[model samples]
Target: MQDYRNESEQFDRIVSIGMFEHVGHKNYREYMNVANRCLKDDGLFLLHTIGKT
Candidate 1:
């Protein structure tokens, strides 16, 4: 688990558009790991979330 967390910070950029909806409450942390690893120290990250109606 720690290894995955450490590896997540190797990306230059990350996007989470429309992904939050698919991420269950139980797996939110794991989902975040994806972005965390993907984003670089100075990389740009964008997130777009749509409400479910």
Candidate 2:
């Protein structure tokens, strides 16, 4: 995700289904930040993860 940081190339939408769980708790902010940087202001972000019951 670091490769996406500060990049001029951005997307109109991003989907992270089943991926955020693998990022771990420690890197959540950084991971999301990277995605944020890669998304346009009016873009949409979709995140899906399995929760423990």
TM-score of each: 0.61, 0.78
Task: Name the Cα RMSD for model 1.
Answer: 4.7
Using lDDT, give the best candidate's number.
2
lDDT of each: 0.69, 0.82
Q: Tell me, what's the RMSD of every candidate? A: 4.7, 2.8
Number of colliding residue pairs in each model: 3, 0
Candidate 1 TM-score, C-alpha based: 0.61
Off by over 4 Å in 1: 1-10
Query: What ranges in model 2 sit over 4 Å off?
Result: 1-8
